[model samples]
Target: MLLKKERLNDILTDMAKQARVYVPVSPDANDGGGVGKSGKAKMTRFELYSPGTAPNFDLVNTTMPPKDMLFPQTQKMYRYGFDTEGNAYIDIIHDSDEVVIFGMRSCDARSIECMDDVFLSMGYDDEFYKQRREKLATVAIGCASVAETCFCDSMGLDPNAAPGADVQLSPGVDGQSYVVVAQSEKGQALVASWQPYLEDSTAETTQVSCALKVNGDGLKDKLEQMFDHPIWEQLSKKCLTCGTCTYVCPTCHCFDISQENKMKDGERFRCWDSCMFSAYSEMAGNHNPRPTKMPRVRQRFMHKLCFFEDRYGKTLCVGCGRCVEKCPVALDITMLIDDIQAADLSKAEEVA
Candidate 1:
């Protein structure tokens, strides 16, 4: 099913009439905590909220990842109580309403699918992630222009490729139309429901939208032998150990679990955590697995490029480049990959 570029929000508002619709909303003064110095104007910062105005579809990328829809920063699992008989009762807090995540990028939507391998079918199953995953539908939009920090190409992601979107919208060469394709059964259902907005796809539209492409097949093997290369040290020098890179990363899934208590009743909450922090993996005895910034840096890349590939047959990174722009030290992952590509690793020991 193909939808017109002009009717995007009309379709969204229609969906919202029946279910909850979440689009990327830019920051207002209320988003970043308090008012500015004048105390009158709301300071605008980057935040993801419900769309107050219609979305700007031609924009490159969003400030935040679409992870919150899949793995919320903080979610309540259940509430427990004891009656007079001391019998424990628990109430599950589940997402009952259907949610449509409109105007998502292919990279961001694909990242959610990558995360599903870990949280859904792996050794452990998270009821929260599973429930939300089942309740949500993703509508992916193609990138019209690439950012300076974007390296979706290096990660073998196409700016126009739709890996995990239920429905993908590719802008036509005419610049006024779109090519819509449904990649899944759910996507097909969605397109069928929005039949009024869709039209038949044209071969011309498909060819024009995906002109940008990259090959990342040898990336994992390339990173393996280049682990000890000098690029690691050079890149680490610019890093501030700030967690922004992972925090804004669409596919980075490291989180910390904590318990909040109130008298006899305590609630367990999980929030976003980063691997860059020195205390991230600190044990009860204060022993840290990653003792230095270099190791921490190494851990992030290795996990994204190596460990994730080893486990799921895909690289963890979607190459959205949120880290490149958000980092205080200007630690760019694309440049690091380019440096890795330049290294002569014929003599280095291979890593699996």
Candidate 2:
């Protein structure tokens, strides 16, 4: 089924009636048509859709990943307070709302799959994450074009495909229509619901390819032996340890849990944390396992490349290249992959 670009708003309006709809909007959409206070262009992020909300399908990928929709940056776990009789009470907070995330890219859709492995698999299920996951339905938009930094193809992903999405939207031959394919029961139902807005048209679908490329072959095995290599020392030198990469990454899921209390009333919450931060691996007595930037930087890359592959049988990175584009310094992961492939392994014993 094909949907015309002119009728997208009508389709979205109807979908909103069934579930809370989120669509990608230009970060500057709310910036009053000017640069932000920092004098930099705002990065696109997903926002709740309204009648006039314009979804930015032209963007390659949003700087802010859609992870927050399911796993919020700051989530209140529970509330604690004392009764009149001085007895303490705790109220668990588990809020779930049915929602549809429209206009997600293939990489972002894959990121959600990575998150599912962590939260839903391996004999453990996070109720907090599970609730939101169950209530959410994803509709991924295939890429019509890619950014210069995007290398999803090198990561074994097709820029124009999202196998994990409930519904997939590919650009039609006309470039003004979308061929919608429903992959799940929920998605089929959604399509059925949007029948009024859809047109019966056959159009050729074009597959987009990423411009950037990297060799990830044997990279994981090489990383297993290159833990102590001088490459990390050289790479970590320019790192600012700002954790911007992890924050922007679609799959970096590290978090810290803490509580806020004032006058006998308190709430336990979890916030996003980065391994690059010194305190992330710090112990009770101020003993830190990863005490230096070199090891921290090495850990971040190794986890994305080697450790995660060993555990999940897939790399943690989806290769959306938000880090590559957003990194203040030229810390490109694709470049690092090439460097790793070119590095001599005979000196590994000496580094060890």
TM-score per candidate: 0.85, 0.96
lDDT of each: 0.73, 0.90
Residues 1-352, candidate 1: write the lDDT tens digits: 4566777766776777766777765444234433564343331222233434546565567777878877877877766666568777766777887877877777787798888988987678888888888988888877767776677766767778677888887877677777778888988888888888777656345331232334456778887776676556666777788888887888988888777766545667678888999989798899998888888898898888778898899999888878877888777676666666667776344421
Q: Which parts of model 2 have CA positions greater than 4 angstroms off?
A: 36-41
> Mind giving the per-residue lDDT tens digits that candidate 2 earns over 1-352?
9988898899888888878899988856655553646475566888898888878877878879999998889999999999789999999998757899999999999999999998999999999999999989999999998999999989988988899999999988678999989999988988898899888876788788988889878878999999978999999999999889999999999999999999989999999999999999999999999999999999999999999889888899899999999999979889899999999988877977
For residue 78, model 1's alpha carbon misses the true position, in angstroms, by 2.5
For residue 108, what is the lDDT in candidate 2? 94
What is the Å distance of residue 148 in model 2 from its true position? 0.3
**Clashing residue pairs for model 2:** none
Clashing pairs in 1: none
